[model samples]
Target chain A: MTLLNAIDPWLAGPRSAELLFPTLALPVLGLLLAPLLGARWARLLALASLVVGLVLALACTAALVAADAPLVYALGGWAAPLGVELRLDGPAALMLLLTAVLLLLIGLHAAGEFSVRAAGRRATLAFWTLLLGVWAGLDGLFLGRDLFNLYVAIEVLTFSAVPMVCLKGHAAQFQAAFQYLLFALLGSALYLLGAGLMLGVHGTLDIAQIRVALDAVATHPPDIGGDARAATLAAVALMSTGLLAKTALMPLHLWLPPAHGGAPAPASAVLSALVVKGSFFLLFRLWLDLVPDLPQLHVGLLLGGLGVFAILLGNLMALMQARLKLLVAYSTLAQIGYLFLLFPLASGASGGPAATAALIQVVSHALAKASLFLLAGRILVAFGHDRLPALDGFGRAMPATLLVILMAGLALVGLPPSGGYLVKSLYASAAADLGAWWWPPALELGGLLSAAYLARILSIALSPAPASGTGTGAAAGGGHILRAPITGLAAPALLAVCALLLGLLPPALFSVMDVARPGMGSATAVAGVMLSALTPSGFWRSAGPVLTVALVVVLFHSAGESAWGRRIASIGRGVAGFEGWLRQWRTAGALLLLFLLIQVWTSIG
Target chain B: MNEAQLYGVCGAGLVGIGLYGAILGRSTLRRLLAFNLVGSGVFLIFGAIARRGGLAGGAQSDPVPQALVITGLVVAFAATALAVALLIRLATVAHEAASAAATPGSTDDPSTPATASQGRGERGPGHVGAGHS
Candidate 1:
C-alpha cells in the first residue's frame, strides 16, 4: 500500500460521511445538550435525536434493500483491525431500525408523560442521554468488526441501563438496581479478562482478521496436548457466562425482576423493551465474529433448552403473581427465553430447518415483547396499582387499554393471528426438522403455560368491575388523572394491532428480513406457519380442566425459590418485618454494623 | 507500585468487595454505595485493559474504551445522582407517610421536608453535599 493509501482511512468518501454523520449525531447531540439545558428540554432534545435517528435508520434500511451487501465505513480512511470500521449490513440495519423506532416512540411517549420535578428534570435528562447511549452502544455493537471496539459498546450499554433501574427513587429499587449493577460489573470484569487473554494470544483484535487467524490456530495439530484450545474455550465460557448474567438468562436472572419490575413505568418500558437486548446483541456479535465458522450447534441447543426452562418457569411465575409489575417482569423472562431460540435457529445450516425457523421466531418475539412491556406500562399508568386482583373491573371502564393488553397478551401467549404465533410456529417447525420433535412439544407446553397466565390477566381484565369499584383507579376519581396512561395505551395498542397484521403478512416480513444472508437454510422451513395459525381455541371453553392443569403445572414449579418465588417471599418478609426490622436494626444495630462492614470492605479492597 | 499495576489489583479487589457488599448489605444507601464501588472498580479494569491495548505492537490506548469510559462515567454519575435523589425522596415519603398516618395532616410540618432536602439550598447543593456528612 502507498503512503497516501495509509494517510487517510478512505479516499475523501461521501459514503463514509453518510454512515458516520447520521449514526454519530445522536450521541454528540446528547453530550452537547445534556449539561447545558435543564432536563425538561433535554428530553425533547432526546426525542428529536431519535426522530432524526428513526428517519436515518429507515433511510439506511431502504438503502440496504436497494443495494445489496453490507455498507462498510472505515474511520479516518484506515482499514482492518488497526483502523476502526463501521459496518452496516442488512440484519444490523434492521436491528437499528427496530431500535430507533421503538426508542423514538418510547421517548415521544415518555417526554410528554413522565413528569418528575427536581430529580424528574435530571432523570428526564439522564433518560434521554442513556437512551441515546444505549442506541449508540447497540448500533455500534452490531456494526463493530473488532473485539476491543465491541467491548466498549458493551460497557456503554451496561452503564446506560443502570440508571433506568433506580430512576424511580423507591428505596427498594436502590437494592434492586445495585444488584443489577453489581452483576453487570462482574460480567464486564469477566468479559475483559477473556478479551485480555484473546488479545495476548492473538495479536489483532479485529474479528475478521481473527477469523482469518483462527484457520492456522485450528489447523495446527493439537498444541500442548490441546491446552491452547483449552485456554480459548475457557475464555469463551467465561465470556458467555458473563453475557448470560446481563441477559438474565436463567438462574442469574435474580436482578431482572427488581430492575425491570421496580422501575417506574417508562423506565420499566425501556429496561424491558431494549436494554436486555443490548447484551443479547453483544452475544450475537460474539457468535458471528469470535466463534468458529462451524461452531458446536449443541451450545446454542443448550441455550435453547435453558430458554425452554425459562419459558416454563417464567410463565408459571407470571401465573402466580398478584402484583401486576412482577407478572410483567416474569413475562419478560419468558419472552427473553424466546430470543435465546435464535442462537439454535440461526445456526440454520447445521440444522437447516430449525435455524431458518429460529430467524422468524427472533423477529416476532422482539416486536411482541416490546409491545407487551409498553402495554403493561400503560395498564399500570391507567390503574394506580398494577396488582392483578386490583384490576378486577378495569376492562369495562378502560376498554381501549384493556383491548391493547389483551392483544399484547395474546401475542405473548403465541396465539394465532399474531406475530408471536408465527414466530412460535417457525421455532416449532424448526425443532421438528431437527427430529428434535421433543422441543416442539416443549415449546407447545410453554405456549400453553403462557396462554394460561395471559388468560389469568385477560380474565381479570374482562371481568365486570365490582359494585365497590374501589380497587381499580375508577374509585380514585379516574378520568383526567391518568391522561399519560391514555397516551401510553396508544403506541402499544398500535404495536399489538401490527403484531396481528404482521402475522397475516409473513411474506412481507420475510422480504425485509431478507437483509440477513441466508447462512444455510431453505425458505420452506416456515411450513408450520399454517399448523400454528389453525390451532383451535376449542380447548378454551373447557377452561376448568385446562385451568386446573395450568395450576398443577404452575404449583409444581413454584415449590422452591424459583427466582420469582424467592422474590415473592422476600417481598413478604420485607413487609411483615418492616417495622420489626427497622426497630431491631436501630436497637440491636447489627444490620447497620453489617452495612458498615460492607462499606469498609468495598473501600479498602 | 505504578498506577497500572496498582489499579489492576485495586480493581479486582474492589470488584470482589463490592459484590460482597451488594449481596450482604441491608442498608439501601450502603447498597447504592457498593454499586458505585463496583462501578469504580469496573472503570479501573477498563483502564487496565486500555493500558494493555496501548502497549500492543503499534497501538495507542484504544480511544474507543476511553470514549466508552467517558460515557460510562457520565452514566454512573447520573445513576448516583438518581440514587441520591431517590434516597431523598424516599426519606420524604417515609416521613410524610409516617407523619400522615401517625400525626395526620402534619405535612405542614417543615421538619418533614427538612430531613429530605438539605436545610440550606441557599448555601447551595455543593454546600449541602458537604453538610450531609
Candidate 2:
C-alpha cells in the first residue's frame, strides 16, 4: 500500500472518494456539452450545472459537518505520492458554494445580456462554455491537494478568464487580455519552478506529504541538511511571489483594473468576484496549511504592509475614476488588500478568526462587487455610457438599481448589518488579540476611504440634472429605453441583500469554517463577538465614521470650483498618474522581481 | 560537479535569461517567447531533479519528475498557443483600427468610433503605438 493509504484508509474508501467528483465533473460536463448544443441549450445546460453544483456543494458541507473531517479522494484509487488527490474541507466547500451561487446569479444575468438574439449565437455559446471552464477551474483549485495540480487549475482559470475579458472583441479589451495573459504566464511559470524545487527536496508533490517533510526538517534540521532548508525557503518565496502576481496584491495589481473593467458586466462580475479569489485561496492554502510555521514576523508584516498599501492606494485610485466600472474594479483592488491582512493576523494565536474574517470578506466582497458590476452594466445600458460625471440624476432613472448599489456600497464600507462590518470587526479583534496596534486603525481608515469613494459615485448619481433636462433619466439618454429584465435587476439586488444579511447568518454557519482547522476558534466565539458588537452604540461607533466621511466626501466633491476641491482633485490626478506609471510593464516587472528578492531574503535570513 | 547539478545550473541560467526577456521585451510576441523560455527552464530543472534521483540511489531516474515535466510542457504549450492566438487577433484588430483611422468617412463601422476613443483612454501614451511597434 502507498504511504497515504496506510495512513488513512478512509481517503481511499468509496464514501469520501465519491464526494468531490460531482462538484468538478458537473462543470466539466457542462463545458463539454456547451460546445455541442445550440446557444440557448448551452446556456440552459450551464445554468443547470451551476444549480446542481450549488446543491452538491451544500451537500458536501453537510457531509463534512456530519463527518467532522476533511474529505479526501485519491484519483483512480492511487493515493498520494503516486497519484493526484482532491480534498474538500470546510473552506473548499464554502468556496465551491460561493462560486456556485455567484455564477448562477451571474449566469442568469448573462442569459439576459448575451441572449442569442442580442449577442449572436456564437458569442452566447462561447460565453457559456468559457463560464463553465472558469467554474471547473475554480472547483479544481479549491479541491486540489497537489501543488502541481493546483498550478494546472490556476492556468485553466487564467486561460478561461483571459478570453472572457475581451469577449466583446474590442481593441482596448484585447490589449488588456494580452497584458493579463503575460502576467499570469509569468506567475504560473514561477509557481511551477517552485513546485519542482519543492518536489526535488521533499520527494513528493502532495501538499500533505510536503508538510510532513517540512515538519520533520524543522525538528531535525541536520538530518535533512541545511541545503534542504534553503531549497524549501526558496521554493516558498518563489511560490508566494508568483501567487502574489496572480492575486494582484498592490504593486503586482497593474493588470487587474483594465482586464476587469474592460469585460462585459457579467464577465466582470465573474472576474472580480471569483477569478482572482481562486489564486488568493491557493496562496492561503500554501501559507496557512503547507508552511504555517515558516512565516516569521517580518514576512507576515511585509505582506500586511502591502495589504495596507493596496487598501489606501486602491481606494484613492478608485475615487479618481471617471468610469463606474473602472471605479468598481479599483475598489476590488482595495478589497483584495483586506484579504492579505489574514497573513499577519494569522501569525498570532489561532489562525481561525483571521481566516474566517478573510473568508467572510471574500464572500461579502464577492457578492457586493458582483452586484455593483451588474448595476454598472445596467447603468451603461440605460445611459449608453457609464461615465460618472454624466450619470447625474441616475437615482431618479432607476431607483431600484440605485438602492441596490447603495446597499452594496454600504456592505463595502463596513457599515452595520453588513458582512463588511463583521469582517472589519473580526479583523479588529484579531489584530487586537495579536497586539498589532496599526492594523485596526488601517482597517478603520480603509472603511472610511471605501465610504468616500462610494459617496463619490452616489453624490454624482444623486445630483440634480441640468436645466436642459438632457440627463433627467434613462429616457433622456438619446431615446434608448431601459428594458432591463426583472431577472437582470433582481440578480444584483439579491446579491446586495445577501451581502447585507451575511452578518446575520446563524452562529452554527460561522463555525463551519472551523472544521478541519479546529485551531481557527469556534463559530460561536466569532458570532458572539458580532452579537455583542451589534448594539446601538456599537452600530454608531462603526457606522458613524463611515457616514460622516461619506458626507464630507460628497460635499467636497460637489464644491469642485473651490480651492480645496481643486487641491484634492490635483492630488487625485497625481495619484492616478503614479498609478499609471506603476501599471507599466517594465515598472511592474521590476517591482515583482524586487518583491521576490525581498521575500527570499526575508525567508533565508 | 555532477551532471545533474550542471543541468540544474544551466536551467537556472535559462530562467534568468527568460525573466530578463519577459520583463524588458517591448513586443508581446517576444514576451511570450520569454515566458516559454522560463517554462522550458523549469522543465529542465525538473528533469535534472529526476536524474538526481539516481545519485540518491532511488530509481535510475525518478518517474514522477519526468511525469511532472511532461505535464508542465503540455500546459506551457497550451498557454503559448493561446497567447499566439490572442496576439494574432490583436494584430488584426489594430490593423483594422489603423486603416479605419487613416480613411475618413469610414464611420459606417459601428466599432470604429468606440475603439478609437477607448484605445486612447485605456492605454498609456507609450503603448499607443503598441501592436505596430
> Which candidate number maximizes DockQ?
2
lDDT of each structure?
0.61, 0.83
* Cα-based lDDT at residue A285, candidate 1: 58
Task: Show model 1 residue runs off by greater than 4 Å.
Answer: A1-17, A115-120, A293-298, A344-362, A468-488, A506-605, B1-133
* DockQ measured for candidate 1: 0.11
lDDT of 1 by residue, A1-605 (tens): 68745522322333432554457556656756765876767776777778888777766766565555566778778987678887776557767777887777666666665545635666677777777777777777767877667767777777678777766554456546655665665566556555654554564667667666665677877754255445555555556656777888754566676677777666677778777877776676566446664235346656677688778777766666666777788788887887777666544323344443444444555566666766666666555556666666566667787677767776666656566666667766656555566666666677777767766666666555556645344422345335444666667766667665555664544545444455533234343354335446523422344466556544534353577767866664444243223222122223322322332232222
**Quality of model 1 by C-alpha lDDT:** 0.61
Clash tally for model 2: 1
TM-score of 2: 0.94
Poorest stretch of ten by lDDT in candidate 1 chain A: A579-588
Candidates in order, TM-scores: namely: 0.75, 0.94
iRMSD per model?
11.8, 3.9
In the range A1-605, model 2's lDDT, one tens digit per residue, is 68756534333344754768887889988888898887878888998888889888877777777678888877789889888788888788889889999999999888867879889987888899999999999999999989989998999899999999888887778878888889988988889999999988888888888888777777775745567877887898899899999989988886888888888889999999999999999888887888746336367777889999999999888887778888899899999999999988884323657888898888999999999999999988877677777777777777788889999999998887788988888888878787888898888898899998888877887777665755434332435546566567888999999998887777788777777886776476567667866899988898888889988988887776887877877776677777777787888889999998888887777
**What value does the TM-score of chain B take for model 1?**
0.69
